[model samples]
Target chain A: MKKNITPYLFAAPAFLVLGYFSILPMLQTAYYSTLEYSFFGPHRFIGAANYVRLFTDPHFWATLLNSLLFLSVTPVLMVVSLTLALSVRNLLRGARIVRLMLFLPVVTPVVIAGIVWRWIFTEETGLLNHLLSLASVGPVRWLTEFPTNLVSAMLVTVWRGMGYYMMLFLAGLALVPREVEEAGILDGATPLQQVWHVLLPLLRPTLLFVAVVSSSAAVKVFTEQYILIPGAPLDNKALVSFLYRHAFERFDFGYGSAAGMVLFGMTLLFSYTQVRLMDREQSS
Target chain B: MRKALSRIVIITASAAAVIPFLWLAATSVKGAEELFVYPPTFIPRTFQWENYTGVWNAIPFGLYLVNSLTVALLSVVFNLLLSSLAGFALARYRFRYRGLLFGAVLFSMMVPKEMLVIPLFTSVLRLHLADSLLGVVLPFAVEGMGIFLMRQAFLALPRDVEEAAVMDGAAPLRLWWSVMLPMVRPSLAALAIFTFIGSWGDFLWPMVVLKSQEHYTVQVGLSMMLGTFVDNYRYVAAGSLLALLPVALLFILMQRHFERGLLSGSGK
Candidate 1:
């Protein structure tokens, strides 16, 4: 190839767009986090006052806790999705139907999914309550209740996630060598032992991918909490929802920016650790 | 016996995964009286197609649909053209800061969207792009995954093609457009499907930016309708169905490319 500025010119558009929208906003967000921004008063530098408020605000702590609690769905999603992948691997029946049905939610708009779920949890006319009544159970408050609301939201997230991750695991499972599985049989390992010792080690990359993606999604979750539990009840609000209410609803830019920074830091830390773990897996 | 057990597990799991969508379909057509009935009919006795039209009449989903299509199509066009170009630059050429630029792209993927919402909104407001579809589209028009996928696609191609083109006096743009892009058809298709679906489903940014009801995307429209239709379960269900239908069908139609997007996105 001849030496020229062509490569630079080719790459210019994407870099410029990302620089304006992604890189610059991040810096502005960092700066906003330190200010006492007000709608009426002149804005002034507060030097971490917003973060300080975050430490003292129990609501902030609760939202952070709720966000972390949402991550409890990660392992469950991985195990269930992977198990489904493994189970369907040798199936001679219903494979196409099963695959289509499971993966459907991955493409559904989150807001739409959340809205449908909201009706499913309706106290008087909900599908769940009606089904529970078959066993003579009273209508259980799902979204209005505390831990149950959290659980319901997590269940939705997990349900929506399983098939997407199942595909990943299936992709990984396909890569495992047939000779390796046969060697397990030659070594007299049971099928369960073969899965535990051989298949899982080979599936590590997909499993890590599922874990990282699921956790990151769990933390950034907004539409579900926004639609399912409108107004973002303090007890059940995720971190992003809290940021929305403060920043957009309250017009409290500084506090929202502070919360946003905390959320961003946690996401970065979590993703960095995940990348490092995957790298370790590769190097080993 | 083991076969039977696995069948049972697979069936049960698929049902769990699919029942909500089934319920969504059912509720979309159920009459007002049947929605609250005991042991709710798994299938509606009366499939009230009117519910669809009712919600259609109630909300400006027509406008919302147009807005969504505009943003998603533009995002797709920009992503396909720009990401492939960027990918070619990184994969086929020796450029300054190429490694750094690629690293930046990878790093952008890790930064959660939650972190950037406030600042992006502030940026949008500052630029007077607030309340327009442009703000909604601006944040995501050039996807990181698109560039990454296109780069991977380009890297897999033989190097000789570009050299041959250059030897024939094909300019950089011509080499990328006429020679190189046609080779990565699969990736371009995958990126198009992925970006279109993502842009269509996007809620948070659009909800924040678009103050006017007319500018609301499908997701934003449905969310706002969700608040107003608290008592109108049928209408809400219809709205939800409307929000989901287009992209859901698109996914069904283009399942192959969408699946490829998923496969490449979950990098090994």
Candidate 2:
């Protein structure tokens, strides 16, 4: 009895804090998502009206499509980083320095990254446009345009993220036994064949983990859009930014919560499906 | 031949990875005229070192720095002590609902942070703690990643040491402090490094909860440097360089621990 009491006492502080801050708030979100409330006054029970409104809204659908578009870049980043990792895995010297350089941006704040990239994407005096001019191309309004804004955001995401994913892939590569490679090489297998047939199979678990994390990150991407391109620019649109303007700027907490809940649901569904699919692949 | 090709690939990839950061630093020094040159100046003709001073004067960056440091440091101390205790319990003791509690902790990791922000903001406001450093630090003090890392570290330890301490009439608290804690130094260091990095880099929650400019974190303060499309890009860049200093230093000083922390925290 004393022994059990001691353990609980030890764990109580953290659990209490986390419970009050994390669990309780989550419960409140679930509760409030069911109600119609605002900062100004009297609240009313609305059952699933918020969710109903969310599904019916075209903007919600647009944001959902935007999120999907944002997510498409993760695979491109994954392939690029994996290839980079594979290319650099064998270096006996300067590899650690190379790895460190790649991972530096991951450690830097996303806000800073967003701001810096915004400067680079600026229309007239931006670094990207300035460089492009040297190639005889006209200046492009990267952030001021719709699809271009999304593309610019994706570029920043890829640049900031690829190194971190490369490190993870490097870790995965480290775990691959050398004898498998040696055997493949002895059998006159090409390097690509060896990687395809031997290394990739062993890397399945790591691939799945990266896929889920990166995908979830892609969906919740707000800082980049918010900092780089604040508004739709008379033609462009950002789903999360639009949601932010509605919630905080306009004080539409109920609507914002509804949007957040939808985003959360989509993220969970996507990540869960990916995890399960990967699990099935591993077992098979 | 393969090795030569690998070298070329690595060089090209590394160049692509690092060029943006280099350009940022270079552009920070370039004059307004040089910035918009037809052919971009990779090197600035005149270094504008005053951009740092200008940026510092433009905002209450000093206050923001203090606010961010205090909140982050306090949060780190709280997390290290609380998480180590919880992690020790989870690792060493058998209690009713032990699995349930551990499972709950793991399950919390899956819930996207965006889902919680609305409720969290409401709760903080209800408690009348909004727009304060306490509001910022309190919620973050109990971290899932820290506990997870510490728990894994504790599990990897030898049981014989604790059993011997028990035979020596050492209380659990004494054993934890004097024996177990010392053994998990690497894990503790890892947690500290990661926690500090996360706290320092965090922007979204601070943006939501902190209303007063006095309580703004460095990230938020930096954002204030850009107002209504009338930004001084050089100053903002200089401020960003300043803001990045601590995190970069922390990473370099504790690179090993940072790597371990990231690996364990991410379950990679």
Candidate 3:
């Protein structure tokens, strides 16, 4: 009993803090989602009216579509970065520095990355446009167009995140026992054949982690869209960005909470399904 | 040879990776006239070192730097202390709901922070803690990732050492501070570096909570610089460079530990 109490005492501070800041707030959001509460409030319980309104709202659907579009980019990034990792996995020299370079963007703030890329993709005096002009391709209004803005945001997201995923892939690659690879090679298998037949199978867990994390991150990407193209031409708002505007800007707290709940539900479901599948894969 | 070709590939890949940052740094030094050249100046003719000074003076950057450092340090200290305690419990103790508590922590990790922004803001507002440093730091202090990392690190330690400490009449706190913590120094260092970099780079939370100019973080200040009509590209670039410098240095200084932390955290 004393021993059990001691552990609870040790864990108390952290749980209390998490409870206050994270758990309590989450509950509060759920409560507020059912009520017509704003910052300036004469509040009344509305019993899922906000959610009902949220479903019918055009902007909500647009935001959901934008989130879907944002999510599609993650698999492409994962494949690219993982491929890069696989390509360089066997290289002996300077792999560390290359890995470092890939992970550099992960440390840089998302807003800063968005700002810098905004400059790169700027229409008139942008570096990308200037480069494109030499090839007579485009002065693309990247941050202005409907799907283009989303694409532009996705491009920056991929560029910034690829390195981090690459590092993860590198770690996964390292875990692929060298002896196993050597055995495959000795058995008259080519390098590609060894990787395909032996290494990729061993990397299942890491691949699943990357897929789940990148997908979750894709869903929650607010800083890029918020910083680069806030309400860009009416049709380019990401879900989280729209949620931000609703909650903070318009003071529509209840509606925003409903959106938050939806996002939470979607992320939870996706993560659950991924983890379960991965665990099943591991067990089998 | 394959070796030579691989070397070329690495060099090219690294170059592609680094070019944008190099461009950002170079553009920071170019004069306004050279910035918009037809053929963009890869190298600035006259390095306008004043752009650094200019951006520094343009905003309350000195104050902003202090605010950022203060918030990040507080967050680091809070996270280190609270997470270490939680990790010790989770690792060492066999409580009734240990699995449940651990599950809660894991669940917190999956919940998107953006989803909680509305309720968090309302809570902070209700507490009348909005636009304050404490408000900004408090919420971020209890990170699930830090707790999870520390718990994993602690669990990896041999139980005999801790048992020996207890047999030698060392209390739980003493055992933790002296024996267990020192054993997990690398993990703690890794957590510190991760938390420091994360807090330093945080923008949205600071932007939401910090209303006063005096309390603005570096990211917020930089964003404000962009919002203002002052179209000084050099200054903006310089500010961006300065904002990035500390984190870059932090990464370089703790590269090994950072890599280890990333590997462990990603469950690789």
Candidate 4:
């Protein structure tokens, strides 16, 4: 009995903290979504009113559409990061330094990186425009403009993610049996063919992992958009940023909680798929 | 030709990865007039080391730095202690509901942090931890990833060692402290550094809770600074580089552990 109790005691702190901070809040987020609450007023039972408002709200739809658009960047991220991983895989020298350089952006805080990228994307006196001016091109506004603003913000996401997904790909690459590659060579497969036929099937798990994680992150993107273009119009904000604006900035907690529930649902779907895939892999 | 092409690709990619640092460093030193030049020079003609000093004084940058360091260090300490305790229990004990408890940890891992913010802020306020560094550290103190990583490490330990320790009449806590903890030192190191980095770089939660300028972390401080010092990019650049210094140093020192941690954290 003492021994059984000892294990419980050892685990109690962790469960306590996680229960209060993580599990409890998750339930509260669900509960709060059903109420009419704000800084100006007390909590009132609104029942489905917040969700109804969320569904009818044009800003909510636009923000959700923007999140889906952001999710489209995952394929670009996968290709770029996988290419980066492949490019460096065979290098016998300087690979470590290359990796360190590439991973620097990942290590930099999003606010700092967003600030640097913001300066770079400035229409005039920015390094990017300065480079384009050498070819006598008109300086294009990168951040404030409609589509370019979202595109530039997405570029930052891609930039920070490159080294991260590359590392994941490299880890997956390390697990592939070497004799399989040799067999492909004996079959007279070119490098690209070897990749397509030999390597990709093995990398399906990693690709799925990257796809799920990056897409979920894209849906939850807030800092990059917030920092890059501080007052970006309604169409430009990601779903999380919209939630943030309503909840914190405007003190509309119910509205924000409803948006949060939607974001949570989307992320939960991705995470569930990832868990299923991982479990399948383990069982096999 | 193949090698050369790959080299060019590698080199261009490396430059793309690194040039931002060089550009940021160069910009941090340039005079205000030089910043407006049609083609910004790669090298600053005059060194403005004073910008670092200026930005340091512009806001309570020193206070923010201290707050960030304290919060990160506290997070590392708490995460190591709590996660390892929980991990050891899960790995060694044959308690009922062990699988259920572990499943709960995994489920919590899947909960996106964005969903937790509003509710967490409310929780923090209820606990009277709002506007404090503890507010930033409490939710992340025992991360699911840390618990999972430590559990894996403990499970990998040879069973004979624990049996030997038990034969010596050592209590469970003694066995954990003297035998088990040292065995999983590498995992602890990885969790420590990762937790420190995560806490240090955290922006959104800190931004939400830390209302006073005195309590802000460097990330929160920098975001606010960006709005006030809109015209002075040099100061902001200097402040950013200064904030980045410790993390860069830690990464260089612990790159191997970081790489290993990254792969393991992803369950690869």
Candidate 5:
């Protein structure tokens, strides 16, 4: 029997790239977290000092809270996206165009969307304020203030994300057999009840997938905040934004890596659940 | 009543989703004086068509576009080449440690790039690739999502086709190149589009790795320019819209493949 070396040869380049780029860098992050290191400064051993500073810092907690606040959008996104999907499914006309319009934001680069939204959210002469004035509401400092800015950023995520998630739900809804809905109708279920019992139950797997994906994305939220708010202070930063600021902006590699490790742990948990969900999907 | 209500809901949602893009298009062509009006007009009285051309000169947008194109194209080429080879090996051959290797690929897929940025930056720096185009492209040249998609594509093919090729004395490489790859053309298209979008729209890594204006990709360059022109943002609007044009065009022309790529990419 010939021992075929073809497979190994074929697989070598990919493994090398992944090893150096993905696997090696992850392990290196863990090491960097332990050292008081920066690109320009000499590496000094700092046993848990960075972690101590991070834990003690109120700003760190603020960023963590900001991340949790970001996660709050996941539920809103699910409801809005699912509603859009279900509504479009029932539409008798222009469903394809409607879906296209909804999905446009998903493909548009976040920076571009951020540019437009920033203009809209400008305080005095901004479009949003002008619209508010029609209802006699004074200009709300959307991007300039703290919590409003965060909420405004969340609005962009929801607007940009719902379309993609809606597509996921649309795919899921397509898989559901027609008979199930018919049976719900025979049982005299209201339109709302039909969704509650028939559609949502079968779409649970997709709901779980969306939940994990959206939450993981929320945890790593960067572009929206970075684009909309620009250089937000420590208190207003998302966890990843905090890590970016420290690592790249401040050049505090040690502190930044420690912050990054925390974010890594969080996203790893979400990714683990996602992988499990996907494996279940594949096997089923 | 129900149908009307649903139509209203969808229309409102679509408008919310798309109006920003329309506003951007309108704002991009507006002259400096036309901006910041109290009742912001939806359409420019006279379209500043030069704004589109001006974006290329206001910054080194041509340089950024080239940088972005090089990174995206190189990424697609390498990702397709390496991932398909690896995927073919995983799907077609039974080899030692195949499961472990496949598992490694899946594991790599799950770990977000942002989480690894600190070390990724340092590693690229150590290898003397930082602030170079290769530095931006190399780390993401072959992604887990590509390999996984290709592997799934290959696995879906029937075994008899490959068996007949093997019986005819075709070399494994030749068999893969001629027989297997052509059958997976749709998957390849899907993977290529995904890779192009990901690489072209990538911001954080490019921003971190690239230091000079000469190396900045469109997103990074436009971001810097936006900061520079905060009060007067017409140029930035034009610049961002230009950056979005290729992708918007891609999405329009290849909607089917884009949707396919996106649904498959739901895992990541």
Candidate 6:
């Protein structure tokens, strides 16, 4: 009899907090998305008007495009991180130190990464342009120019993300059977061929995991936009930053929640896929 | 020859990886004069350790550190207790709605934080938790990842010990405390370290809830300082380095466990 009730007692505390805070807020976000809501009240119900505004609004469209563009950076990120992972994972000695060095960026706070990277691309005395000048190249307006502003921010994301994804890939590599790689060599495969033919297939699960996780982060990135170019003209607003500007800056709660809902939908799509893939992996 | 090439590639990759830190360490120690040279030297010619002192005094940086530590500690404690309790329930006892409850937990994990910020802040505002450490820590205290990690840990425990204790008339809670908790130390350590590391560096939620400089986390303080220290890049760099010091140390000390925790939680 006591056993029958004990589990509920144990789970109740966490569920209570989660219910009141996390899950409830998601419902509130959806509810507020349909209304002219604020700290004061949800004064009026305007069904899908906020959604209509988002579809028609040029700013919304631009940020939506930027969200897609931001996510596109993941492929580049994966390639670079994979390359680094492969290189260091097979090292005979001091692999730990190399992995530690690479992983440093991941552990560093995002805002600090943002500020430091922003400084690195600063026009006059920043590191990148300083290095460029010694090669007799003129200073590029990395933070000031149109596409460069967005590109520089994307570069920072790739930098911060590489080590973390490298760690994931290394974890995957550890699970791959050694005999398979040796067999690839015995079949007279080149190193690149061994990777392409043998190791890459085994790494599919990790690749999917990285892709999904990276996509969610990429679409929802805020710190880079906030720190690098806070009011970074309409051209480069990621969805979360755009939501933040409206909800916090302009106090357009309805519009912001509408935008937030879209972010939620995108996250759901990715996470649902990830869960499906992961559950499949577990079953297999 | 291939080994040599791979080593060079690995070395160069690591060097590139640490370039920001290299630049940060160099820039933070540069005197005001040497900072704007036409092409700056990679190394600081003169070490200006005062940047650290200067930045620390420029604001209530110490207060930020204290507040961040407080929030992180509260988050760690809450997560440990709540997650372990929930984990034990899900992994041990059979209950009606157990599946539904666990599904809710999984679904809650799927909700991107951006979706919750507005309503969450409004709740924080209503409860008067706004501008307090509790507000910053409350939402994250019941983390899905921690619960999931704890559940996995609990599930892996051998059943015989629990069954033996139960047959001896041990109460559920008693068996949990006496027979189960000791065996899951590694997972608890992993959960606590990850929670501490995450809570310590979190910015977005804290940014929304916190309005006062007095309650700012280090991440918030750094961003806020960026606004005030446009010309004082060296100072900002120093502040950035100082903020990352503990995080780096923690990672170095628990590098293996951190990797294990991450891989077990996600990499499997």
DockQ score of each predicted structure, in the order shown: 0.65, 0.56, 0.58, 0.69, 0.70, 0.72
Preferred candidate (lDDT higher): 1 or 2: 1
Alpha-carbon deviation at A101 in model 3, angstroms: 1.8
Encode model 4's per-residue lDDT on B2-114: one tens digit a residue.
57766777787778778888888988998888876867788989999999999988788999899999999999999999999999999988898789878877788778898
Better of 2 and 5 by DockQ: 5
Q: Which one is best on DockQ? A: 6
Candidate 4: clashing pairs of residues:
none
What tens-digit string does per-residue lDDT give for candidate 2 at B100-125?
A: 77766665665667767777787789
Q: How far out, in Å, is residue A147 in model 5?
A: 0.9
Q: Put down candidate 5 lDDT per residue, B101-122, tens digits, no spaces.
A: 9899889877878878888888
Report, for every candidate in turn, its global Cα lDDT versus the true structure: 0.83, 0.79, 0.81, 0.87, 0.87, 0.85
The candidates, ranked best first by TM-score, are 5, 4, 6, 1, 3, 2
What tens digits encode model 6's per-residue C-alpha lDDT throughout B1-268? Answer: 7677777878787877798898889989988888778667788889999988998898888888888889989999999999999989998878997998888877887889877888888888889899999999998888777787788788877778787897899988888887899999889888988898888878889998899899899889889888887788888888888888988999999998887877767737
TM-scores across all candidates?
0.95, 0.94, 0.94, 0.97, 0.97, 0.96
User: lDDT by residue for model 4 over A1-284, one digit each (tens)?
Assistant: 45468788889999888888888888898999999989678899999999999999999999998898899789999998898888888899989999999898888888888988888888878888888888998587888887788888898998888999999999999999999999999999988899999999999889999999898889888899889999779778789988988999998888899999999898887887666665444334
3 or 6, greater by lDDT: 6
Q: Output the TM-score of candidate 5.
A: 0.97
Give the fraction of true interface contacts kept by model 3.
0.56
Q: Write the per-residue lDDT of candidate 6 for residues A17-103, one digit (tens) a residue.
A: 989988898888888899987654545899999999899988888888888888877899888888888888778789888888988
| lDDT head-to-head 3 vs 5, winner | 5
Q: Candidate 6 has which clashing residue pairs, if any?
A: none
For candidate 3, give the lDDT of residue B10. Answer: 62
Which residue ranges in model 2 land beyond 4 Å of their true spot? A1-3, A233-239, A269-284, B228-231
Q: Count of backbone clashes for each model?
A: 0, 0, 0, 0, 0, 0
Which candidate do you rate higher for TM-score, 2 or 6? 6
By TM-score, how accurate is candidate 1?
A: 0.95
Chain A: TM-score in each model: 0.92, 0.90, 0.90, 0.95, 0.96, 0.94
